[model samples]
Target: MTSSLSLTKKLVNVAMGRESADMVIRDGVWVSVQSGEFIPNTDIAIVDGHIAYVGGDASHTIAQDTKIIDAGGKYLVPGLLDGHMHVESGMVTVTEFVRTVAKRGTTGIFIDPHEIANVFGLKGVKLMVDEAAGQPIHVWVQMPSCVPSAPGFETPGAEITPDDVAEAMTWPGIIGLGEVMDFPGVFNAGEKMMAEIAAARDAGKVIGGHYPNLNLGTIFHGYVAAGIEDDHEGTRVEDAIARVRQGMKAMLRYGSGWLDVEGQVDAILKHKLDSRRFILCTDDSHAGTLTQDGHMDRVLRHAIDAGLPPLTALQMMTINTAEHFGLTREMGMIAPGRWADVLLVEDLNDFHPETVIAKGQVIAQKGKITIDLPSVDYPVWARDSVKLGHPLKAEDFALKTEATVGTPSAPLRAQASVTANVIGVIENQAPTKHLKLEVAVEDGEVSLPLAGGKEGGADIAKLALVERHKATGDVTVGLVSGFGFSEKCGIASTVAHDSHHMLVTGTSEEDMAIAANKLAEVGGGQVVVKDGKVIGLVELEIAGLMSTEEASIVAQKATTVLGGFKACGCTLSNPNMQLSLLALVVIPELRISDMGLVDVINFELIPVIETGK
Candidate 1:
């Protein structure tokens, strides 16, 4: 850790001309994120990785030994911060993710490795922390609070208890508790959940929230009173306003799929609310988006185009995020006594960092990384984690329904309708709609949409959750709509949210089995198969949620994965993201898990087939 005391002494000496600075960035236009003002022709003096002077004419603190960078009056802003994100969701390891996004000017990231934690528990989180500790940029970790996300709704590979959270708080690089995914548990004061929150409070750390529920009733009040300081789950302007009004930081997100900045930015533009209480984040980004597009840079451009002033957008990414996390003095500015992480950008609106400096060294410039980032390796246990109990066959995905309730019969007598629950997906948002439909029962089985009949389906298909944590050989099936898929295709992945179980959704039973077995055969990853032919695949070697592959390779495979989803007749912009969230029991209204279909609003598991149909 960098010592503030030692840094202060060195910066004081450098500014007083008692000693030479380590580096001097001369003649730069400083975009002061702290004051929302621009200072032209500013010379920033740095000593021991801390800013010493910020005014012009720093020749007095410079020597031949000091490295000097001429910024040439370009806007030097603080390097960006990804306030809330998951490194595992990028399908890359922590080291790989940092190397990929750092060149695009992301100097700091607050990551929640809950996906890996769901698969490997505390050991997985420790592996991420160890890797993050060696990175060049600030990679703060929020300990995974809920391994199963919502208990009784799904089964995870491992479980995290309040004791686990209390122990992790003492670890280095731990920023706070991860997004409390169990919103219902917190609001209702579930003993274990509240104990975990109490541990973070006792340790004086922040508690990130994942309250995607739109209920502004007593539940929302109870949640806010229980102490959720920052939330990145808002998808509308009203949701953003509610968070800020309740003394919480509203983190308007623009992830790969959840494109929320456009809607929530309206809170500031139309409602004219204080922008200080709002922060911008990419809660999740796949490898392709992180490599091809940008991290916070992509978000900032969208925020600016959404009618936010350029400076206000920067504040959301830098200062607002830092203040909410209580790290203002250490970062979020180009001022003295702060880390010397500054970006020399060509245009504030375009917002690409042409020259990036972190800790007084120019690390990246012109879309290329200059620093040497050594490859970090994980142990053998980190890989080879896909465990399907037995070889899966086409029969596993078959949702059997008998004439008698609670009993399943195959090869049915035709001409019967059964009541079933379907996961209705909401586009450009996280929540799903729980729809109760009267489905056709043919040959004693709940007929899929593909099986043509007079009942005429809801355009929904079969959804299955394969237990991968243990050799459980458990496959729980449900129904879902909104993919608009209309082919004999299926997509499978082990990246299911929070629980990280194997999820497969398809119209054809044959293709669903093919996709699921393919993932198990390759340990774990994502696959799309149409008519027993594999089309798209991306291998995640670490905990079945991340890859140790180079960023370019992973991004290429991710692109292919998205292409495959399109080939399978999916029209959602990011279907893979949708597929991953199918098992996320935290958000409403319905999701499928290893246990069964979950009604997330009620925080309980519901039978796939409604009784007495």
Candidate 2:
């Protein structure tokens, strides 16, 4: 490593004003992502965190200690880059996130810390930026433009104004403004929202866009004319074509549940649009997907399967993304004066990165990370986030109604929309169903609250959102179905996305209360309880969202938690996914936010109604 650092000195001696290199890889095929072509029998040289040579053999100009890596007929491609993502979505710290993704040959990421920003404000974005700068790979963070995501529609812990964007642009790793999630505000010409976009422009930084609607008339054109550069909200071919035609790079993502690549790849396959205007990203993926599947590597495979050529897939992840972010000169190729980031893959179609290097350092070899990273410390404020106003009781969730005064026996009934708008769980899609279900009323409410099984008991369950941000002492109560939680068990998590609110779901209110208190006792984390006994707990003290713990340690704890859910008969793909989306108010069909039950399609708060009256 010391010799590699000194390599830059040797390169400067060779050519002060010219592009040269210190370390070079001989006998390799370069997957040129810029032109969607592969240059065979090529050599790439690197110096000073930039590529200095990309031609034939460079064995003649080697220094005494200049390290040489023989690609040995393998394909050399620029390291992968994710166009849009959230670091906290992995439930791992930024350092851990980098360490985990390095093994998959991910050299760059465009992250939006908006999830954390909505909970902790500027301090959260700063924390992410600091950690990003320290990483061996590139971690470019975007200043969160929208705090509550939707202003006045919802309330966030802190607000980020136009001034926040200007101030954050001065930060070292602040690449640009984050995804402009407030499309409503932007289309409506809200002064505060437009001013933030202006600030980003004044700073000469890129602006990320998030327009999730399918309407392609005036609103879409209005969004592009407002100075947004790239968008990852394209879920259809037309959506991708429209963005690219309007001079916006269309990002195709395939995360844990969001499968968008297959549809948007049509822009290249069918429409024959400029492939240079497309990029690939995993918008939100968990640790399991990162460890087991891959990071950008997974997106690449899916893109290839979606009918895009191998070279086009590589371009979308590397050169295309780098060009969009204005980092092409520094990265995106094995050419001269670029970062020494390369992936050695035996097969181009599968594109499995066997050896990975960043800044002339071997970070991963054969799908294994070789870097050693230490854990960061969590402050007292971050550790202590869960706070309930008061101990929750069974009656706290009681539904009151007008009862008849003189009836000998009365049916416990109240008026309610029998069929509910259920948030349909699609395996690999972000769009949800506007499902409705009608059921029998119980205790004057439409709750299918179930208790411990085997005996003829109750069929009621409980869902609660504990106030953890400010110790506000609020627990917004609601009902949730389809978890398949049997027996008296409760699942709790502080890693709730977007708001970082405390979400606990259980069959018995007693176990739910116990689990919530346990999470509070540990400052902040995830917990699973059954019959009043602690089943699993993963301590995430940093911002009540992530633990500065080692990825392996956190993953191990999370595995145990999943096992706990299985013990209670919970069987969903990543059962925690269901828990996380419960509080997300952006994606529609149906959802529950901190404000109340939300009809996400209409963006309105709906009341949790009682049974038939």
Candidate 3:
């Protein structure tokens, strides 16, 4: 093992032409992200996995054993970095996620494992940290600040406390605290939230922020004053401007479902704010997106299409992201003393890497991985997480109502129509609309065809949250619209956000029960059932949030699940991604949990049926 002092000395020797460098790449246009310049005919020298020299020529550092590669005048750009993301969102493990993205030139990532933390607690986070350590590229973990996302609003399988945050701060590879999603808790002076923030501050680490509220008033100022550093939830120009004005970096994200960069990039292009304070990331990309499209490369291309200069977009994903995490000396630039993480691309607009190098090693060339990635052997407990008390029946998903519609003394007829609150899903965005629609009541129960008939009708479906963490036979039922399901099918997913409960939605009650039970039988995964038969499934054996299968295979299986949504007549883009967030109670306006239906705007529980109306 080479010591850091010895490595520095060797790097100095190679730079001074006293020793042969391990590798040399000659005659490339250097995309200097630090200075935002494009210099021609630049050559780079690497020794001991660190860059030694980058100047006019590196011929003196080359020896008989030095491996030399001709760049052929391609643009030498720094490897891309995703400053904020979640590995679980891809439905793959850390190793598999890296295998898919590293070939696409994503050399570094900052992941928040709060999704698994909700199910397995701190032990689960340790599992991710251990897996991240073995990856070829940089994978940093942020201690999940909110396990349940919002206390009293929902109950999680496991809970993370301030003590857990402080303990994780001492662990290796922990960059900072995860997104402080409890914005209300921060401004309202909640004890647990404050203590968690204090833990990251005491450890001198970065603290991520998540402020979804659009109102940039006193509450927003209060949230910023709580020492939150950066946020990726901003979806507007004003949102980006306000965050940077408050001394927080604004992360513009372009994921499979959320395409927020087009709206937020105007903060720099239109408002003329400094681009250094803006970073690019993919908050929640599914396996289909990673395998089919790309990772950070996709974000970079999208950012450029949003009217940003090629160099400006590249800087946002590379140097800007690195500087935000205080890792400039280690990675994120094509300069001396930094890791040799470089990408050779022919076209800046397309942003496809012709050659990918990390730590002075050629890992990929021409869109294929040159080396093999080792498989991870997850423990038995992690594989077997979904535990339903018993097989669910159709009755469990029944939305029963009281016999009286109005006051008991002045009760209406038994078959009268009543107003019901519905959780509405918006396309390509995180926030859902709280919809109110009138539905007919028969025999003290609200059934399907709540408003209109099946085809091109109300577009309403039954949403059920089955508590799988504990063997508690609790299934909270609610109503949701905007899925536009026109068939008699049900979709079930164990990848519910923040709290990994089993969320099932369908037009048929029996199919909903079948979908839920099928996932429990397979440990955990996303399953689609139609007319009592399983049509598509992707088994996530690890933590019920990710699969150990290769990313391509998982993406193939997940694609079928997306097709299942289309077959069920749902037309939303990335419907499965939207389905997964229906239970995220922290985001407005309405969501479901194991306890009951949540009104997130008010942080209270209201009846699915408006009582005494």
Best by TM-score: 3
Report every candidate's CA lDDT.
0.87, 0.76, 0.92
| Model 1 per-residue lDDT tens digits across residues 1-613 | 5576776787888999989998998898889878889989899999878899999789989998999989988898998998899998899998889888988999999999999998889999999999998888899999999888888877898999999999999998999999998888888899988999999999999999988888888999999998999999888888999999999999999989898888888889999999999989999998888888888999999899999999999999999988888898989888888888899987998989998888777889898999987678789888978989888888998998755444455333466777888898887678899998878787778876653324444578899999988888989988998887767788899999988889999888888888888888887999989878988899997888888897889889877888887776677888889989988988889988777878887777788887663
Give per-residue CA lDDT, model 2, range 41-101, as digits (tens). Answer: 8877666656666777765556666678889999998899998998887778899999888
- Going through the candidates in the order shown, the clash numbers are 3, 18, 0
Best by lDDT: 3
Candidates 1 and 2 compared: the better one by lDDT is: 1
RMSD of each: 2.5, 3.9, 1.3
Count clashing pairs, candidate 2: 18
Ordered from best to worst TM-score, the candidate numbers read 3, 1, 2
Give a tens-digit lDDT track for model 3, residues 79-112.
9999999999999999999999999999999999
Model 1, position 79, has a per-residue lDDT of 84
Give Cα distance to truth, residue 357, candidate 1, Å.
Answer: 0.9
Candidate 2: residue 180 Cα off by (Å) = 1.2
